[model samples]
Target: MSKRIFITGIGVISAIGKNASETLSSIKTASSGVGEIQYLQTVHKGKFPLCEVKYDNTQLCELANIDPKTRITRTSLLGIIAAQEAWRSAGSPVLGDGRTGVFSGNTVGGMDKTEHFYADFMQDAQSGDIKTMLSHECAESTERIADSLGATGMVSTISTACSSAANTIMLGARMIKHGLLDRAIVGGVDALTKFTVNGFNVLQILDEEYSQPFDENRRGLNLGEGAGFIVLEAEGIAKEEHILAELVGYANSNDAFHQTASSPDGTGAFLAMKGALDVAQIEPSQIDYINVHGTGTPNNDLSEGFAMQRLFGENIPKFSSTKAFTGHTLGASGGVEAVLSVLALQNKIIYPNLRFKTPIAALGGKMIPETALLENQDLTYILSNSFGFGGNTSSLVFKAYK
Candidate 1:
């Protein structure tokens, strides 16, 4: 058997909550974080709804314990907060003895700051404080989180758009399975910025009101921002600590179908889900729940719903898209939903797809509805999907800790 990887800890910060506990509470109550934009100084403020973190930069800095005068980006600050929570939740075990690694994923990185200073920098490239652009690379936030947590070994990043965090978790699992690391801190973080908002706006996929995933009349997706991290350790090492969940199966696939949309048949989504089931050695019927990549966009919801229909057939497992609560968190969606999946297994509850109304006509009513808390349900195995731009897709299977 392959080396077992266990999730020892989890942390999250999104529009819904400042930490994992708060997020769980919101999910349980079906409280949505999507609303009018607050932080980002976008022209589309009243025109578009967003799942922006409630804390402003100053508040986030205080919560992250970052120096008030530090020139860090909101992306890094959000990551530090969530990553620190995960580290502490994992017992803050001694790491960086060359047996630990940090694998983080992100798409926005420090763009929030870059966009803030771009005009001034353009006016005077020589006079501008180049330091503001120092963290522009996608790896900067990952490095910041790793440094803050004292993860001094094998720091790296993955940036495959929305699947970034799922890929990071996959990488960490492989590293542990191959004896490259005994423990790995893995997750992704992204902060709202004018860049992403405008980008999605131009694509005509940003919902003016709150998004409704799997709904027939869904307008589009509401952009969101946040971070989530989980600590993965070899089973032997995890036995010394508390095991939150088990990482049993994971897979990544690329459809090369379209740059900004999924294929009509959800090829990448199907392949990734199938590959994950194969790796876990579990039948499709074994999945007790599915956290779908239902972004509420016309193409994404249709594609993912069709994929579920193909994979689960007539008796599709209970499934719902939590994005309606948190919005489309871009690269952090995978990590955020992964944490939710683990929480579902631990709590024996499947979260409702908030705001869901009419089901997608294409899927023949396969989508999970906004049912009451599925309390006492046998949620043993869960599959979480994250499909991103450029046809990059990933699926993670998290099981109840045995």
Candidate 2:
């Protein structure tokens, strides 16, 4: 049998909170971070709601303890902050032994900086600061995080859209299961940029109001920005008391039905969830709760709801999407949700799906999400789903440490 992978630590920075503790407090109190745009300089500033991290670049640098004078992208800064927190939470293990790896995911990369560079470069060929474009690649943030943590093992960056971070966690777990690494830092990050904001706006999926996932009257997703990372260690390598949860299963799939929409029948979603269950050797009924990929978009909620019904049948487990609190964080959603799942397992609490009122008629209006927080429940195995554009879907099964 493959070795078990245990989550030893978690770190996150989102609109709801800046760290794990604050995130938990927000969830417990049903506080949402979605609000009017404040940081990003865009025409949609007052037109659309967003979940920005609430920290400027200089402020983030100070929190991450990086020199303010250093030229860095917001993506890298956010990643460094979350990654450092995860490392410290994991007891600051020595990574110079070369058995630790860093796997991160993001679609935005340093577009926040790249956009500024282009604005000036387009105006004048040599006017834009070249330094601003240094961290433009998707791998730049991942590399920066690895360097910061002194990780020397396999370093990879996955950009499968919204499923990006979940895929990183899956990859890290697989590598450790195969004896490739003893420890892995896996998650994703994305800083809000004019490019992403305008892109989604052009797609007409940005909600003017706070998003309501799985709601019949849901408009669309509210864009958010942040980062989340978790530390995974081989069962034997990590201290028993430090183990937060066990990553029992993970799987990825693609529907190939549309460029930006899931299949009407949820083929990719079902396959991904089923595959994860198969890997974990568990039944669908075994899942206690689900952190669904309910993006508050009509197509996504419908598709994911159908997928869950197909898999769980009449016994669908209690589930909720925390997006209502943090907004649809795009590439960072997977990692952010992953951290939330671990928090749920750790706290035995079910976070509410905010703003949910009426259920979708297509799903018989019976698929109502958890609208109120429930504390001290029996949560064992939780399934978290992250579906991205181009039908890329991923699911992860996290089991409470026994």
Candidate 3:
């Protein structure tokens, strides 16, 4: 029989709050996690607003069930913590032999430690940079997370910039539908590092103040980091445990326009949304809430706004971006946002698009940029978008289990 996939559980560790419930609470209050960089010591600490996780490395290690002396990078440690949440939330299931697997997305894997090791190695080539820092490569985090979760089958990671985790979830659903595996743990994770901080600054797209997405005066993105994961199980398996949230539709498309910028009209974004709707066999009007990939970047907001207008026309469903709460977790953002959307489905909450004062003149204020929709009423289907660097775009549809 053809299998259907469901999000059984979610675990998240973000800057806004450590756990999913806390993150949700912060979102409800529209609490901005933006502040001076507190976790890492950097020269630009107070010059710009960045969302830094409050925990120290020791705290993160304990959460991940790892030894602080092991020297795992922040990226891999973040994945472990969130993946543990996903595994625990699934009743801590011990799958009977090879029925389970894992797929994750991440870009900065163990980079924090790798950079340090590299710097040390440069000073003295005899330094054992490969000891704890060997798995600093992006794929290493995925391998380590799979090991921690005991997922022996088809454990892998995808690194397509920002859309990494969104596509990870999409791939997991497809694998189940094709009988590749019965159940899969899928998500993404990223941790803050000085490398990313300096990189964004070089692009000159980062905001020195709070990030204002979908707002005309918005400066740029505020880099935040965290880990988020979701357990995707075959319908028959998850329904037995009442751990199912139907992953009805999803799609991914590349803009092929720019290395880091979106197309002028969000052509790739449009393709992804349309593809997701088609997969769900639903029309545009049928969508209830949309969790947009609003990065607050000038190019992203303008392009995404244009795409929304072209697709749903006048009746754009209530939509918002959760970046204000967690900031952008890079590869983990998609997984984190996906879990949030499922929460929105289960709770019928439409999170606000924080800092949205004025809409772009081009899109005609199409999005419902308000924080009040989250606590409104019943919701049916939600469309979530995750657009990444390199013109990669992905969208997923989560429907309340009936």
Best by lDDT: 2
| Model 3 residue pairs with clashes | 350-374
User: By TM-score, is 1 or 3 better?
Assistant: 1
In model 1, the number of clashes is 0
Please, what is the whole-model Cα lDDT of each candidate in the order they appear? 0.90, 0.93, 0.84
TM-score of each prediction: 0.98, 0.99, 0.96
- Which stretches of model 1 miss by more than 4 angstroms? none
> Model 1, 1-402: lDDT tens per residue?
668999998999999999989999998887999988778897887988899999999999999998889989999998999989988888888886878899888887899889867878778877566788899998998889988987777999999999999999999999999998999999899999888999999999988888888899999999999998999999778855489899999999997899999998899999999999999999999998999998989999898878878998887888888998999889888889988998898899998988887877777765656455678878789999999998999999999985
Model 1's TM-score against the true structure: 0.98
Every candidate's CA RMSD: 1.1, 0.7, 1.5
Candidate 2: which pairs clash?
A: none
Rank order (by TM-score, best first): 2, 1, 3
**lDDT (tens digit, per residue) of candidate 3 on 236-256:** 778556564789899999999
Question: Tens-digit lDDT track for model 2 on 1-402?
Answer: 678899998999999888999999998888999999899998887899999999998999999999999889999998998889888999999998889999999998999999989989999999989988778999999999999999999999999999999999999999998999999999999999999999989988888999999999998999899999999999789998789999999999997899998899999999999999999999999999999999899999999999999999999899999999988788888999989999999999999999999999999999999999999999999999999997899999999996
